[model samples]
Target: MRPFAFERAPDLAAAQRVVALSASSRAETVPAMLLAGGTTLLDLMKLDVLRPERVVDINALAGRFGGVAAEPAGLRLGALARMAQVADDAGVRRDYPVIAESLALAASAQLRNMASLGGNVLQRTRCSYFRDVSHAACNKRNPGSGCAALGGCNRQHAVLGTSDHCIATYPGDFAQALVALDAVVEIEGPQGARRLPFAGLHRLPGDRPDEETVLRPGEIIAGFLVPAGPWARRSRYVKVRDRESYAFAAASAAVALDLDGDRVREARIALGGVATIPWRAREAEAALAGQVLDEAGAERAAAAAFREARTHGDNDHKPELGRRTLVRALLEAARMEI
Candidate 1:
C-alpha cells in the first residue's frame, strides 16, 4: 500500500473542511477518501487499486448518524449503524424482514459486526480484474483503458446492466432490499443535505465506469429511510451462490408482495449479483400485479424480470439463474404469513 496521511474529523463540519482542502490540493491524484469501517477502503488500498493521498476517518461522527429508530412514517437507519445492529434490531427483523435477511446473509458474522450499512451499500465490485492491479485492462480501475472481463472469464460479472466499457456486477445485498422497498438515501455535503431515491444512487457503466455513484464531490451518505408499507413484512431475499455461506451471490432476488386473497395487490422486486446496479424489476412486478400466485404467474413474472437482460459468453446462464431466483422468492413471499 502507498503511504498516506490519516486524520479524524470530530464533526460533519470538520469532515467537510478536510474534503475541501483535499479538493483544492492538486498534489493528490484522487480526492480524499472517507474511512468508516475500513472494510472497503483498506482492502482496495492494500491491492494498490486506490492510492488516496489522504483518508478522513469518520468514526467520530457516528454519534450523530448511528442510530436505528422506528418512526410512525417509516424506519430510519443511520449510515454508521453496524450491519449486526440493524439486522438484529427487533423492529427491523419484524417489520422489514428483507432488510434484516439481506444483511444477515451477507459476509460473515465478524464482517457484519464491523461493517456499517452505508459502507456496505457503497462496496465496490468483486471483479477479479478490477481488484488485481496487475490487470491494466479493467475500465473501472483505469478508465479508457479497456475491459478484460468482456472477453475473459466473466461468470461472476453482470448481465443486466452492462456497457461495452465495463460489465462489473453490483456486489451488495442490502442495496437490493433498499431498491425493492423504494427507500430514500439521505446525503450531506458542503453544499447542503439532500434526499434522493435509493435507486438513483448507483450509476450504470456508460463510458466512465470508474465513476460508480451519483454522489457529488464531497457528499457523504448520512442515512436511509425505508417507508412503512403493507408489503414490507411479507418480503424475502433469496441469494443463490455456488456455496451457502461466505460466497457472493451469482443471482439474488428481493421480493415483497401485498396480496388480496390469492391475487396480488402489489409486488416489488429487485435483483442483485447479476446487474451493474441494484436492479428493480419493475416489469416483473407489473406482471404479477393482479395475477394469482400460481406456477403460471410466477413463471410469467420471472420471464418478465429477465426480458431485457443481456449476457456475455460465460454469464449467459445468469439470466436463467436470475429468473429462477426471482420466481422462487416471489412464491415464497406469497406464502409468508405477515
Candidate 2:
C-alpha cells in the first residue's frame, strides 16, 4: 500500500473538516479519503487504484453513529453500525427480513463483522479493469480514457444501466434493499446535514463514469431511515451468483409487496448486480399493481423490469437471468407468512 498521512478523527466535525480542507471538484479524486471499515478503501488503495495522500480514520466517531434502533414507526440504522450487528438484530430480521437477508448474504462472516452500513453502500465496482492498474482502460478509474470491459471479458458487467463510457455493475446487496424500501439517507457535510432519498444516492454511469455517486465532496453518510410500511414485512432478496457464498451477484432482486387478498396493493422492486446503480423497477411495479400475484403476473412484471436493458457481447444472458431472479423473488415474497 502507498504510504500516506494518517489521522484519527475524534468527531464528525473533525472528520468533515479534514476532508473538506482537501476536497476537490470531483469526489473520486479527492486527496484525502475517509476510513470507515477500510474494506473497500484499503483494497483499492493496495491495488493502486486509489492513491489518496491522506487517510482519515473515522472509527472514533462510531460511538455517536453506530446503533440500530427499530421502532413501531420505522428503523434507524447508524452509518457506522457493523453489517453483522444489523443483520443479527432480532428486530431487523423479524420486521425487515429483506434488509437482514441482504446483509447476511453479503461477503463472509469476517467482512460482515467489519464492514459498516455506510461504507457498504458506497463500495465501488469489482470490475477487473478498474482494480488492475495494468489495464489502462477503465472509464470508472480514468475519465475519457476508455472502457476496456466493452470489448473484453465482460460477463460480470452491467446490462440495465450501461452507457458507452462504462458497464461496471454496482456490487452491493444492501443498497438494493434500501432502494426498494424507500429508505432515506442522512448525510453530514461541510455545508451541514441533509436527508436524501436512498434511491438518489447513486448516479448512473453516463459520460462521466468516474462520478459514481451524488455525494458532495467532504460529505459523510450519517445513517439510514426506513419508514414502516405494509410492504416492509413481506419482502425478500434473491441473489444468483457464480457461487453460493462469498461471491458477487450475477443477477439479484429485492422484492417487497403489499397484497390485498390475492391481488397486489403495492410492489417495490430494486435490481442489483445488473445495473450501474441500485435500480428501482418502477415499470415492473406498475405492471403488478392490482394484478393477482401468480406466475403469469410475475412473468409480465419481470419482462417489464428488463425492457430497457442493453447488453454487450459476453453479458447478453444477464437480462434473462435478471428476469428469472426477479420472478423468483416476487413469488417467494408472495408466499411469505406476514
Candidate 3:
C-alpha cells in the first residue's frame, strides 16, 4: 500500500545483514521483514496492518533450505518447503499423518502451494479488529491501545491462553500439529543458529500482546525437526468450522495416540482455534496415559484440555466445543489402522 524497497536476498547471510542494518538504524518504525512465500506478509501489508519499509525476498535461498528429508532418526522439514510439497510427500503422509493433514486442511489449495512452512507457523491472527485498520482498539495491531475483542464480537476469538490484554487466537493449524509432535524449530540470526521447542516459539498474549513469537529481531526460521515416535504413525488433525471450505477453525485438535492392546501407552494432544497460541495439552495427555481408549477416557482427556479455559460472553461455548472436537479427533486417531 505504501512505498517500500524490496530486494531478493541471494543467501541467508545477505538477508541477515539487511535485517541488522535496519535494526541498527531506526529508519523504519517496523523491522525489515523477510519474505518467503509472502502469503501472510503480503496480506497484512495490503491491509495496512504491517508497514515495513523494506522487505528481503528469501526465495533465492530456497535452493539451499527447501528439501524435506525422511530419516530413521526423524523427519526434517526445511522452513522454505511449500505446504503442498510437505503435505503430499509420501513419507510425511505415511509416518506423520497429522502434519500432512494440518497442512492440507489449511487455507486452500492455492495458498498451500504458495505458503512456506516457516511462514505458515508465523502467520498472524485473523481477528477482524487486527486486520481492519478502522478498529483503533486492537491491542495486537496497536499495542497498549485496547483490545476490541474483549467485550465486542469475540465468538471467533480465543477462550484458552487468553488475557485481559488480548483474546485473538493463533489461526494456523500446522502449528498445533507441530506442538503436539514436540517439534523443534531451527532458527538462524545475527548471533548464530539455535533450536527452540516448537511449543515455546509462540508467546502467550500476556501484557504485551503485540510481541507474538520468541524470535529475535533478525532471526530466520531455518527448519523444523520432528522426532520419530510410535504415536506419530497414528496421528490426525480434526477441524471444526462454519463451512466445509476456506473457513478458519472454530475448534480443532491434533491427536497422536499409541495404544497397547486397548490401553493407551502414550497420547499427545494440542488444541487450536480456541487458544491464544498453539496449545499443547500435557494435562490431557497425562489423563489418557495408561487409560483405556474409550468414550469415557476421551471425554476425560478433553475435559482436562479445557480445564483452565476462560471465555467471554460470546465465546462461552468454545470450551465445550473444543472438548467435543478433541474427543472426536482422539476417537478418529484411535480408530486409524497404524
User: Candidates 1 and 2: which is better by lDDT?
Assistant: 2
Compute the lDDT of residue 76 as modeled in candidate 2.
Answer: 98
All candidates: TM-score: 0.97, 0.97, 0.97
Model 1 regions lying over 4 Å from their true place: 19-31
Clashing pairs in 2: none
- Candidate 1 C-alpha lDDT tens digits along 1-338: 89899889889988776656555533315667778888888998899888788899999999989989998799999999999999999999999999999999999998899899999999999999999988899888787889999999999999888999999999999999999999999999988999999999999999989878887766788999999999999999999999999889999999988999889999999999999999999999999998898878999999998988888899999999998998899889988887
Task: Tell me the tens digit of each residue's lDDT in model 2 across 1-338.
Answer: 88899988988888887667655734334578889999999999889888888899999988878899988889999999999999999999999999999999999999999999999999999999999989988888878889999999999989988899999999999999999999999999888899999999999988999887888867889999999999999999999999999999999999999999889999999999999999999999999999999999999999999999999999999999999999999999999997
Pick out the ten consecutive residues of candidate 1 with the lowest summed lDDT: 21-30
Query: Which candidate would rank higher by TM-score, 2 or 3?
Result: 2
Best by TM-score: 2
Candidates ranked by lDDT: 2, 3, 1
Q: Which regions in candidate 2 have their CA more than 4 angstroms from the true location?
A: 25-30
TM-score attained by model 2: 0.97
- How does candidate 3 score on lDDT? 0.91
Each candidate's lDDT (Cα)?
A: 0.91, 0.93, 0.91
